[model samples]
Target: MYENTVPFKIHSDYTPTGDQPQAIEGLIEGLNAGMRGQTLLGVTGSGKTFTMANIIEKTQRPTLVIAPNKTLAAQLAAEFKAFFPENAVEFFVSYYDYYQPEAYIASTDTYIEKDCDINDEIDRMRHSATSALLERRDVIVVASVSCIYGLGDPSDYKDLMINLRQGMICSRDAVIRKLIDLQYVRNDFEITRGAFRVKGDTLDIFPPSSEELLTRVTFFGDEIEKITEVHYISGKVMWNRNYAVIFPASHYATTKEKLDRALVTIEEELEERLAELREQGKLIEAYRLEQKTRYDLEMLSETGFVKGIENYSRHLTRRKPGEPPYTLMDFMPDDYLLMIDESHVTVPQIGAMYN
Candidate 1:
């Protein structure tokens, strides 16, 4: 496991003024006294954000700030990143730029499949947010309602991480296999995100955790020689590191063993569902469900993935029916602080996550 002991220190030029200091102190006191929640009300120009930062510093706990929308989340993320530049400040919102939900109209007998355009950078940052929660302390994730939605199982995601250290004994073939298991693609020609390449004895791993740095694992015969961080664009050796960790390329990462088990469970569920539909004399529905499921199963067996895989997350993550899906909140420690921006609006949005 990764370790981070740094306190939540703020680097703001302006100190708390007016009621800001009082509010910060009260919040910290409440937290220390085991209060469940406390509200901080402030008007415009009151510097509420700064007050929250101070509270976080005094409490010295990681925090998750939820906003009602993406724009507010982004703005808050930028501000917190500036305030705690030494810590891990991450942004996490929905990747979809524009999303139209899949729908069916029985009157018109129309089926409209969902369509979306994902912002790659946002998706990468989402991965970074979850990774930071698992690998580091002093983290602040400013997210939108998308965070309350289903996310990958935290246990499985953490288990998929690959830890490496300089001078460790490991074979090249074994390293490559581990990378593949972490969903890293092998691209010998071009270097990009979540890709690995071999140049002689050096294995350049383009980890998805960082957008700017690439991990260079140079092997001397059967033993590990060195580990260094390289700039992705300039190809300059930034610095040498004693240890390195590679997070999964995709958040929904799983081992082939789990995948095999999930496939069997999914197939059994499909049979049961189809039988229920047939008993209700819904032959067309049963046939449609079978067709879709079989096609997905075939894709999973052949390519290890299928579109809309999250729809089967219960089986994929080995959760029982009616069990609550894991969300980004699950990645954070239980004692982590939570701040809801514009709670009057954001609270309702969070409450409607399952509705």
Candidate 2:
């Protein structure tokens, strides 16, 4: 059994009533006894979320509450945040407000390119969720089924983090280059998420995980001097820190070396697939595949990404065939608790996800 170093402190006005205390005790006991799957079996208005919160408090483990839809996920996140005001309560769902995936219809001889419109606020929340998991132990993430989708390797994300400390000797130009490599853009006029601006001796950054706060780093010549958090709108310094850690701007972050290796493997796979298609007398299929792959390869070589880039995630992550892609679950600590809300519906939905 893992020891709980961080205690779960639920800040609420009301205590557990009716069967809630009993239910909480039962759940906690089951969890302590290594019960893998146990249902709460509560009806409407049974204070299910309250009981779960109590259980979390008793268990003292980071928890993930998966809701069936975005609406429910938002509601759960709000409730959890209210319960654990001082702890980390984050919401995570698909950032895309609208997404039409790429499609190819052989019978109709038609192809449709992928299109998506991302919600900036939701993207920020997703980043906050991931960052909280990595930085804290008292975290509760309320999420939708999008949690099962592909995310960058947790190790790679940690490896790419930039740590800035006061008195550390570092060049300003080097810092800017590192941020650029992590997908942060330089915008002097507009301060926004994933963007940074540089003045004579100070660098202002709007980190992806933050919504209204900006990080100000003052450099003295080639050495770091100070780091401060400032209000973006009011331009008031909230606090000062000697050090800070900045994560990548995007979830798909990778190193240049990985990209180079992936490009080579992609080419080899394309050639091997083309040869098989030709041997099977599928000339038209082979020609179409060759043309599309070559175009994507050219785009990737030029820009480091192509349309439908996620299709090559396996190669980029260097995973073998049939290996499951890393998901949000991978970001959680090993002893974290996973609570599937409305399991009657959620269970089938999770099962159907693979199909």
Clashing pairs in 1: none
RMSD in angstroms between candidate 2 and the native structure over all alpha carbons: 2.9
Instruction: Write one digit per residue (lDDT tens) for candidate 2, span 1-355.
Output: 1121356788888999988888888888898899998899888888899899988888779999999999999999999888888788999999998999977776666766789998999999999988878877888999998899998788778788898999999989999988977878899988899989999999998999998999999999999999999998798999899888889987777788887888899999999999999999877778778888899988777656676777888888899989999999999999999999999898788889956
* Per-prediction CA RMSD (Å): 2.0, 2.9
Q: After superposition, how far is residue 61 of candidate 2 from its true place, in Å?
A: 0.7
Question: How far in Å is the alpha carbon of 300 misplaced in model 1?
Answer: 2.4
Give lDDT per model, in order.
Answer: 0.86, 0.87
Best by lDDT: 2
Q: How much is 115 displaced in model 1, in angstroms? A: 3.4
Each prediction's number of clashing residue pairs = 0, 0
- Among residues 3 or more apart in sequence or in different chains, the pairs in candidate 2 whose N, CA or C atoms overlap within 3 Å are none
